[model samples]
Structures are given as structure tokens and as C-alpha cells.
Target: MALIAIFILRKRNSDSGDRQSSNQNPQGLFSILNLEGKLVYDEIVRATNDFDAENCIGNGGHGSVYRAELPSGEVVAVKKFHSPLSCDQIADQKEFLTEVKALTETRHRNIVKFYGFCSHARHSFLVYEFLERGSLAAILSSDAAAQELDWSQRMNAIKGVADALSYLHHDCFPPIVHRDISSKNLLLDLEYEAHVADFGIAKFLMPDSSNWTEFAGTYGYVAPELAYTMKITEKCDVYSFGVLVLEVIKGKHPRDFLSSISSSSLNTDIELDEMLDPRLPAPSRSVQEKLISIMEVAFSCLNKSPESRPTMKIVSQQLRT
Candidate 1:
């Protein structure tokens, strides 16, 4: 149902060569994705053992992803659209072009690195930098992983995610709306540094128009404004980030709190230590104060009014200390 709310907001948006989607259909007419014969199709097949089950890493609405280690010893992630996705030829072609255009135009430390892709008649796949630590969702799910995720580490991850969105919203030529920002989409490196991935074919908003389509995002993390608005804005991501920040510190989803907070009748004040993840020791006073301030920013992001949310720039600045 929460994912359904994000639906009111999502609009449209995929692969290319040296890179492309690992599908068999021809991607439609976006010039950037027209690498045609240049994508590394052979390597992807060899790396995934012909799409064997062993290499499969994760699956989602867009496609099934695999963690493939190529012959060059470089580990990369490959996302292949399922055979059943009902996209028209033109849309598929455009998705491919969108991926090429966006990634080629933007460069930032927090954004995921696109390695290349293959758009084919038999299989289509997107090659992206592989992150060993996996998605933020994976870590928060495991007892061992959650235990090691401390206060400082959690803040670092927040900053990384902020930086990625900042680049997408401010540095791109026309700017890009990720349309998808949740724990599942945020991958982590060996040191657990956040690397915002899954941008092969993200949606973009016009100068002043709200782009609408079926909603896209994980449950409990989507913005409430998206529940009724088709206009995608950076504020949508801001709301999701607030949820992520709370999820990281609490060691769980903040759905219950969201439910309670939305009611607006209960007292809102609470001790910081009481809400933090019990897996780790309570933070020092300085960190605790900072966390409190950060939480304020997070809550502000949750405002029902989209315009009330802070920009990624403001969010990143608040986390720097």
C-alpha cells in the first residue's frame, strides 16, 4: 500500500553499450543508447554463467540483478529486465537512451558508477559497479550487520546518500529525479560507504511540470505527498531520506512512529537514547545532540507539504558536523 502511494508520483523512464539492458528486444530510438554493436554482451553472459541462478543477487519491479565477477577480476552488477515487463518498443528504446544520457552527463562520489550495458535480441542487461556490502536494507536486516552499524557509520551513510541526490538534483544539465530512493536502492561498499545506484533509466521532471505514472518505491519509505501528486520533486526523495535516517538509527523501520506522528495528538518529545538502536551503546552527548538536530531535519522532511522539505543541499550541510 505504501508502495502504491509512490505510484501517484512516478512517471516514465533504461540501457546502452560497451553497455545496455540484458534483454533480447531492440531498445527504441534514444541516441545515447545506440551503441548497437559496441556493448560487452559476451562478457556479461560469461560472467553470469548464461544467467544461471548462482549469480543472482536480487530482484525488483524493474528487473532481476546479478553479482558477476568478470574475467578481468572486476566484480560488476547486471540488471536484466524480466520477460514479462509490458513496455512498448518505443518506451524501451527511450529507457535505454535515458540511462546513457543521465550517467554520461553526471559524475559524483555518491552516485553509482555505470560500467556499460548490452541491448540485444536475446538478452538485455545493465552493467554497474558492484558493491559488496549490498543494499542498506540488507544490512539493517541482519543481526550481525546491524550490530556493527554504529552512530558515526550511520551518519556517514546519510551524508553519502545526500551527496548523491545533491548531484542528481543540482549538477545534472536538466537535473534528474531518481524517482526511486529507499534502503533497497542504496548500495554499500566494502567499508559500508553508501553508493546510490539503480540510475540506468531514471525519470526526469520538466522545468515546472509534475511527471506522473505508476508509483515506484519501497513500502514505509515513500513520501506521503507522493500519495496524491504525480509531480516528482527532490522533496519526494527528502521524505524517503528522513525515513531512512530514522530506520538506520532505530535499527528498524519507523512505520509505527510515522503512524503515531501522523495522528498529531500524542506528545512528540522523547529521549534520544530511548529511540536509538539498542544494538549499539548510547552515543556520546555530542553525537546525541547532533542526532537530535538531525532528527529535527528528518521530521521537517516528513512534512505533508512537499514545499516544506529541505533541499538535498540543506540536508547534507546539517550532516557535515
Candidate 2:
């Protein structure tokens, strides 16, 4: 690991610059390796223009993300967080550490690559490999972008996310539960391939611990069980994944549709074609049959009882078949 110490006398002229820089800790520590740490740091700082609003691409619960191009002509996503040394920023720091920890422990093709991170007294930021297509939510929200994501591409996205979740839940030494999994957290590359991002609230499913914690997930994406019990498990992520798959199939959130299907009074024999996004043409027969199977797996993940949800490994294998 490359450790570089630098002084941050100047801060971004933004709303996050409320606290004054202190002289006691003249130099802030930057943890990144082998990529010319100081030079990369300087390039990122200059490229972002002190994290100007124009460079910002998106805002999330944790921090604002900026798009930056290094001198090497490499484009990257820089997530500039609120100050970490301040009292009010304690929670932000914990979340930042959580992301760093989670990303460092696991790696997969369908997971965003963490290039480096800076934990400065005046400012904190994480660098990630930039994806051209942006978030799944953003693309699905746009008619043109959604149309570009055809039936095959959509299926690939779902499979990619499932593969990543399987790696996290089963492959890792101490299995991880992504407390937050939503369309917004799933990014898409140029080919519309899904890459899971944002691990601010991820927790390790330590066998000894009950893993009980406060609710931490996107409103509609969170599992229903979280509302009644804080005890978190891998199943919470499964439920969120189920919702995401439905969102990918249908062009929007499936809240009303899911509720209607849950009721025995409503007709349950909904056609697979009817559930697909209307912006694109109907899929081929083979694709339609595969989609039907995928839909079945997704609905099973949404089972009210957490124990009934299939393990991510099973979901991944089924999708592959």
C-alpha cells in the first residue's frame, strides 16, 4: 500500500466546507498503492477543480460523486464525502470506512473497482473505475436509455447482479450481507452490464453475532421483515434483489403489481410478455421462456419468510441454466 502524507490547506468551495482546517494535523494520510499516489492525488484534485459542482455526476445518501479525468487520460468516479473529522460527520466516516472495508475484502467482475481512497481532515473521497452507462435507476428512468437496454441486455444485468451477490454471500470467508441493494446502487457499463456499487451499510454475517442493527436500505427496496425486526441477514439483500429484478423486467417499480399479486383475490396468471418493459419490442420465444424462469426465481426471493428465500448461489446457478 502506498501511503502519502499531504497538507490540505485549501478545501472545496462547497456546502461541505463548514469546518476550518486545523494546524495540529498539518498533513492528511492517503492510502493507495503503486499508482504514483501523490501524482494521482494531485491530478484528481486538479481534474475535479476542487470538486466543483460541474464535475459532480450524482448525489447519494453518503456523499456526492464526481467524474474526473486524470493526466493519464483515465476517467474515474470520485466520491467526495463530507468532512470526516467533524462531530457531525462521524456517521459519514463510519459509512466511508464500511465501504472501504467491504470493497477491500471482496472483488468480482460485477462489482465496482475501488482504485483508491483519501481520508483527509478537510476532505474525504473514494476513487472508483468509471462506468459509462451510469446507474441502473438512471438508465431505466430515461426512455431512450431503457430502450437501448434490450431483452438480452436486461437478462445479463440481472445475472451479473446475482453472480456478484453470490460471491459476497458465500465465497467470502465471513459472508457479507449487503444491507443496501437497490437499482441506484447497481451501475451499468457501456454494454449495460450491471456492476454492484455502494457498500456503506454492508455488514458481515458473523456466525457468533446475531447481526441485529438499525434499518439501513433504500425505502422501497428494503425487506418487509426489517420493518418489524432489526435482525439483518443475507435474506434482506435477497428481497432487495427480487425487487430489482422486477424493476428491470417491468419498466418501473413493481410495488403496486407485487401487492396485487400477493392478494389471492387478484388473478395470478399474468403473462410474462405483459410484465416486460413496453418501450422495447417483445422478446423472442427462447428469451421469453428464460424470462419466465427468471421471474419465477425473483418472486421466490420475495417470499415473506426470510428462510424461504433461495441462497444467492442457487439463484446464480438457476439464472445460468
Candidate 2 lDDT tens digits, 289-318: 999999999988888889988999999999
Model 1 has an lDDT value of: 0.71
TM-score of each: 0.82, 0.88
Error of 2 at 48 (Å): 0.9
By summed lDDT, the worst window of 10 consecutive residues in model 2 runs over 20-29
User: Model 2 compared with the native: what TM-score?
Assistant: 0.88
Q: Which stretches of candidate 1 lie over 4 Å from their true place?
A: 1-39, 84-97, 208-210, 263-268
Cα lDDT tens digits for candidate 1, 181-228: 788888988887998876644766556444665676677877876677
What lDDT is reached at residue 289 by model 1? 86
lDDT of 1 at 107: 81
Clashes of each: 25, 0
